[model samples]
Target: MRQIEYFVAVAETQSFGAAAQSLAVTQPSLSKQIQALEADLGVVLFERTSRRVSLTPQGRALLPDAQRVLRQARRFRNKARSLGFDTDIRLVAGVLPSIGAYFMPRMIERLRQEMPGLKLSFVEGSSSELARQLVQGELDFVLASETDRTDLARRDLFTETLWLCSTPEDPVMQSDAPATLSDLKGRTLLTLSPEFHLNAIVARLAAQAGATLSTEYRGASLDAIRQIAANGPEVGVLPSLYALGEAIRDPHFKVRRLLGYDAEHPVVFYTRTSSPLQALNARLADIIILEKQAIRAERAPQFQV
Candidate 1:
């Protein structure tokens, strides 16, 4: 392994002196290691000349395999270190602000209880933004809506229905009957910014029902939309869990299921396909799913009405 490392260092730096400097070894020692490696492989690994040093055919063929070995070795070391009693496991995770509002407090509490040594950092963003960060390696995992992106591996967490929210003075709240999509026609529908999957879903619903989406009242988050809807006749679309958890208790808001409209968003936990944290990520996903199921179970009767 040491000889292979020396060979790789020489291949990368293309100079024994530079490779030795980088590896903190004497130049002659580095050269001896490489010579031993070439002898064992029975091939010349590099072609050396006064002007430059380049890989021989054998070395060119071996470079990719050597890099893969190095990567796997590093991963092994990291996994071992993570298991140490004093090592703190750090993870960066992302979640949709709307979903996080509903479930994160409980989920985070559970994580703290179960994995005391794990240090978690969270970032909230729209589904699209979260997916982009996951792909860019900025996030280890994200809870978001299912997307068409092939670069991410997704696990279905739960599906939540959409609700129509408005202040008591809104016309839709004048009667006990549930409001249908068509009832929203000619009324301003406020929604989160387009980067959100909920925004896209609401846009489609409005288009299908001939309702006008409020261009001037776009919100950056569900809270903003709910606050805006409180001041006027505008209706805001929100996920059922969020509505049940927060909006229902607010006297200024009326939350209702849309009649005849089966609008639901499937939430998913996703990580990069190449991620090394697959097992840990899966465990976290399971925690979120269990918490969501518990919440829904507790709120079932309220939502049924």
Candidate 2:
């Protein structure tokens, strides 16, 4: 563990003195630990210079695996500390912005009630961005709708309805009132950017409708897309949660369903195939599943699209 800690500190700081200071140890002690580690592995982990320390090619190759080991060691330390006077259990959780705004509060409250010792940190990003971060070990788990479950170990959390929203300030022609694929023929549509999950769905729908949807004012986040839709004649398709609560609250906004697309969108939580945070991730999933069950029982509409 001494060798592991020394290697990580040195790699991160790239200076022996800085690493030593960070670890609250003497420079000589840190150098000895790194030397012991290199000798045990039969590889030169780092090259020492008067000005700066640098990782050897071998060290660069081993950094990620070594970081995982160090992270696991820290998790063990936290688990041990849980039995002591220190009661905090730190965990990092990521989610797409829309769901974080709407569903997260309930799950967070339940999580706090169930695990008072746990301190959950939430990060918001596009699903693809979150997935990349999860793979890079920056996040323990992600709650998002667009992540590919086949490439990751994931659990379905909940599903929401989707809808197309436009401001009532600009009503559609009578032929387009009960909007269908044919009715969208000449209408210009404002959609979310490519980063959003619903963007692909909306694009496919437009293709089937033989309509060209312009994304010049597109945004990746649900909140931004809702705002764009609320401004004027722009039509933005969004999840039921945002369309209903934020976009619809304005009497100027009108909600319409996409003629030929799947109504239910599956939202999920994902973790890497091999992660040290499995137990913590599963605990969070249990809370999500319980909340999902309650929401489904009530049968409330999350989207009207």
Candidate 3:
């Protein structure tokens, strides 16, 4: 393994000294490894001179094959690490409160059906909070919205649109047209907590539309926003996943669309970069996506347009 690494490093850098600098090894040590590799393969790999060193014809032919071998070795190492994770190891997952309330059940059910002995624990918080925990390694997986993070490996699980929910009796909602931001001017708009990504989006839109975001009251979960919207004149903004679920459960739920806005969030599973659990995480992400599709299908007649 070390020989292959040394060979690829030198071949890529084209300098034993530079490769040693990058690999944090002595040049003489790197040269010794290369010599051993050449002896094992029975090939004169490089031509050495006072001013320069270059690959021989045999070295040029072997470079690509050596690179391929390095890639295979890396993949083998990753596979072995992933397999090292015990099935009974308790996996800690973080989730946004709103998503977990409705979406987690199907995921947990499916995961358990596949691995009945899998020990699992769930921690619920705002998306930003969950992301912080994930980065700190306090959680194994997190179902959250996009954040300014590049350290984690992410798989998009669901993309959901924002909906303006209100009582049908609200005078503005009596119209046949989709609700526009203009329709919200001077009206009270309920929003999720400031920590939620939706809150910031709603705040920005409210400023543009001349609407007033109810800062004194931010709904902690989508259900809280839905509850207030059910009987109040104040419009609430929430993801379509929750609105669609409510609409299907109670067809009378007042779930309306934004006239020209595609304001949305991508719910993603974020785990450690190059996580060994990625193989398992992929299966979980797929199940969440299917759940999103199932909910959309359940009430497609009203919202699909």
Candidate 4:
């Protein structure tokens, strides 16, 4: 491809020195490339003398096609840029299963429409596991809870509030207004297993609200808590996105934000400090932000209620 470019440059200028100058390369390098091109094609492409350089008959015959190839290549590049990726980029990304369950489906759909050439294979795990994988160079980036690891660079994507969730027939759903911390004072809160950062948050909120945090039946995932709630009366604390998913899926499901508590956690994207994919990871975060925003818009009524 480069040889063809140099060939065209020399053909246009009809001088080695001029072509080299136009290409910002040494004349010898340009001449070498042209010679190599001719060697590769098995044809003599130039008639050379001290004062002039002119194309041979064979060179003239191939010049038009070579120019056509270069034109097609340019069009290829432009079209790729128009589609949002000039060159294809593949990433093995890690996400927290909690968010992945609710948000990844929409995110992936939007990503396909916006950047078809950006390929991603998603891995789901606890935050610690994801961070370990990232540090060991197993993942391109991770979307999970914030971490203070000196070796990892963190970018704040968004903050999501927590909601207390249960089936509509639960005693706590008797009122349509937002629930108060007082309402949870005597209840047992179902929660994710201690491996999750959310478990600690749930423990803290339980302590503040005078509720019992159930450890005897810790859930392995957010969906596990939802399934557990389906057969029991225990309330589960869930992040806004996951709670929104449950509320939308079941007409009898109920979620209530705490009236006096600001229970939100910051989400982050983590990668190694010296990662070659810094810009690409930032773009991924931007897309996630947009997708989350669209979700917020779509569920604005649920949020408002």
Local distance difference test, each candidate = 0.79, 0.73, 0.78, 0.81
Q: Where is the poorest 10-residue window by lDDT in model 1?
A: 79-88
Every model: Cα RMSD to truth: 11.5, 14.4, 12.4, 4.4
Candidate whose lDDT is highest:
4
By TM-score, highest first, what's the ranking? 4, 1, 3, 2
The lDDT ranking, best first, is 4, 1, 3, 2
lDDT of 4 at 81: 59
Clash pairs (backbone) in predicted model 3? none
Q: Mark the 10 consecutive residues where model 2 has the least summed lDDT.
A: 170-179
Pairs of residues clashing in candidate 4: none
TM-score of each: 0.69, 0.62, 0.65, 0.76
- Superposed Cα deviation of residue 106, candidate 1 (Å): 1.0
Winner on lDDT (2 vs 3): 3
Kindly list the per-residue Cα lDDT of model 2 for residues 157-176, writing each as its tens digit. Answer: 77766666666564542233
Ranked by TM-score, the better of candidates 2 and 3 is 3
Q: Which stretches of candidate 1 lie over 4 Å from their true place?
A: 1-87, 175-178, 248-252, 259-262
Candidate 4 off by > 4 Å: 1-18, 21-86, 167-169, 260-262
For model 1, residues 60-121, the per-residue Cα lDDT tens digits are 99998998888898888887767432246777888887666767778778778887777777
**lDDT (10s digit) by residue, model 4, range 1-305:** 99999999999999999899999999999989999999999999999998999999999999999999999999987865544342477778888876778888888788788778777788888788889899999998898885546689988898777777776678776676778888989888887787777777778778889998887565457877877776667888888888878888976677787654546756888888988666667788898998888888899876752
- Tens-place lDDT per residue, model 3, 154-217, is 8887777777878878876676556788888898888787878878778777887898888656
Using TM-score, give the best candidate's number. 4
Runs of candidate 3 exceeding 4 Å displacement = 1-89, 114-119, 175-177
Q: What C-alpha lDDT, on a 0 to 100 scale, does residue 177 get in candidate 1?
A: 62
